[model samples]
Target: MIFGKKRFPGAVADFEKAVRAQDGDAAQEAFARLHRAAAKAGDGELREAGPRLATLLPSVPHGPRAAVAVVIGACVERGADVSACAPGILAGARETFALAADFCARWADTGGGELPDPDDELTEEIIERAGYEPAVGWFTLPQWEMASVAVLNDPAVRRESAGTAELLALVERVAEASDHEFRCLAYALRVLDDEPLVVLHRDTGTGYALRMSGIGDNFQLHTLLAGVLIGGKHLPGQAPSPQEIAVCRDAPGQVETVGSFNLVGPDGTWIFNEGTPTDIPVIDGARLLVLDPPPYRRAWPAGRFFPGMRGDLVLDRVLDAAETAAWFAKVQPAKR
Candidate 1:
């Protein structure tokens, strides 16, 4: 060890030993040691050691991949020319993100964390140009939907530059942190809201088609819910009438076949695509209807994830809930 601290090489060597023995705890400890060492080391020292470090990244467990990438992100942040190490970093990132996608898919019925195919020509092109600012659109997002999700969940990140370093920073922050699954959806929603892709088609007069590219049937319903909630609040004029809200709720079903959405009206519940116009009777003084995602089925669910949760309250609760759930699940046994 150098100066009574485990230096980069020694830390990496310890990680390798942990990996060889398949000891996850030991591997994490070694990676922590390596991270601390990298932090203490200078830019030139990291840049000089880049090649070997990049090569070792893919071999490590997925849990530590972003932590390893953090070193690279920091190097890039500090303006180190990582051109020689970029290829290796990209290759490892592809593998790690794929593993992350699969891991997250296990939590939710529909969200597999959808990373783009790394082998695709367009993906390679984006990665090639990732050294530039425009790389924000494709490389960071398509590579891992979680990055998109993270961007959406955190308004700060969504509003900032979603460049390579920022994307890497998000992955590092979330991967081994907490609320792995919920945060992914929360973050993705923030990204989706800011994303230029969601074209609002007011063709139906009251409703709009939320055409977001990466969003599939799984997310289509949630996207629709988000659209209605967002649109109701920020429709630029008066709050949408109950009739307008009813139409918007039904719109997603016509567009996507997989999921169904509905709104609880003043008179009764109105099922999307199932009821006639007369069945969804209008109320003179009805507020925008509240709908919940499937399986939860909670009545008048206030926000996306919790009840009585307005703007700032919603953000805090959802984030705190997700983080708490993540921590709880880890310590307690699974229940039926």
Candidate 2:
């Protein structure tokens, strides 16, 4: 009971007491004490104290989690300069994110599980929706995907980094934080437009295979979506096409499979594929057509888990819209 504050064994210690306490009052009191302690202590200087403070609060049911989010959100709202508050706010937010990730892993389909799998960290749905399969026999996305998603979802992070001159800084931060090559994210956001992989058969008038390596197993795929431009060079003896999907052999000895893609038309409707085979041929010196990833379908209708959302939940909603899809599919004369 140093200075009227009883330090617990660990973060788990405080959390368990909160969970097991017979009365809500005891838990609330413990949480308030811990939250204040953590906030006042700032960060890094506290040794293991940070985890201990984080664990004591009611993370679920929106009590402590909401409080932490509120505090960080307040810092942003109060015009806290990026130089002063950004690091601590990001640290606090990361702590909260860790807690939430733990909470999510403890529950199974019914929302109770011990912890999220360090392995099997991704779902087939994410893969299909994102338009590229994980490396052979792998699950979850690579580091670059995680970085991209985080940047897209967090408004504060984006607001701070949004600028004309700081593009290189933004890319460097993404590379450092995501454990991926800065060039990878840059290509995805700018030239490639986040389609995972793209294919083209134009430049050399033959099929060209661009292999992606490093960060994990090698993956090869291709696409040209709206506003995305790529040089279509083909492999030897392979003809080029303006409106066709290219199926390529992965590495060696691996069976070739057609990748599912979405062709979003200007109209509200969408075109999708299940990776079934098509008997399309190629011609020389014509337009180039990309095999975009397929449109998303809601496994459980929206508002089931995500409230106020109608239809299905698409990860990249704005970029995935039918208008965007159609524009990408629309044939335009290649810029000379």
Candidate 3:
């Protein structure tokens, strides 16, 4: 039941007024000002909550203040009415909807749905109706609450899709990586193997080409389409354009994508002109894995301009420091 109020007055109030009203420039400015208040005492909750809620609202449904306050309380101590807040969390952030739905539905608690049998086509029907189908009716039914139920209950997704060649081999290798309960694009990380992979798809004037980086750690090239990246951008916050979104669809019957890369060795390097397989060194050792697509054949280079996005730069930064790797690999691993 928390309400958002104008904490700042005077000219600040007037500016905030414009911002909340959806005045683009003012909204951006207001966001900055509000962001500063995020860390202050009694403000930390709202501060953290605002950004997350911004993503959820208009897509899910709920208030930001109430949601953040509940999360804050949950983080500090127990006995919080999380079930009450679960809907708010889901209502606000789509990225968290799966988890949030699990929470509000009280999946793990006593009197919870626990899980339904796989033959439960009822759950499948719910998913079909609610999951990415071109309408919003599913979110309104009991289905949204049970969405994650079908997700974890279905043994099919966990068993892994098999029986292809090159890409399939690469995907199976992903099994070697860390395991987290995967879902939707989050599962993409398992194949792509990391947090979100950032790609650059700029208009290279030759139509448009794409390239991603994760080289030395992953000895494979992630050739992708501009549409894939752009598609993810349409999720309510940003409209991923050809420049922002790049396609990484799987090739055939296999669910593996072209941009998928699994760590095979340390010599991961980009090969320019596949005509001869030239080595493009992993940017910053292995911190950068580059994905370069074939040239777009339009407007001279007028098809797709391949803009290379900085893939997991963290690994490159890590690989750059031999000492850091040694410390963790030797010093830490022995203790564990």
Instruction: Give the top-scoring candidate (TM-score).
Output: 1
Give the per-residue lDDT of model 3 (tens digit) for 141-224. Answer: 223223222221122321332221222222223222212122221222122223222222212211112233321112123222
**RMSD, candidate 3, Å:** 18.9
Q: Score every model by TM-score.
A: 0.30, 0.24, 0.22
Error of 3 at 128 (Å): 24
Model 2 stretches astray by more than 4 angstroms: 1-23, 37-42, 45-196, 201-336
Error of 1 at 187 (Å): 14
Extract clashing residue pairs from model 1. Answer: 149-187, 149-188, 152-187, 152-190, 152-191, 153-186, 153-187
- The lowest-lDDT stretch of 10 consecutive residues in candidate 2 is 301-310
Instruction: Assess candidate 1 and give its TM-score to the true structure.
Output: 0.30
Those runs of model 3 whose alpha carbons end farther than 4 Å from true positions after fitting are 1-91, 94-105, 111-113, 116-182, 187-336
Cα distance off (Å), candidate 2, residue 32: 3.1
Tell me the TM-score of model 3: 0.22
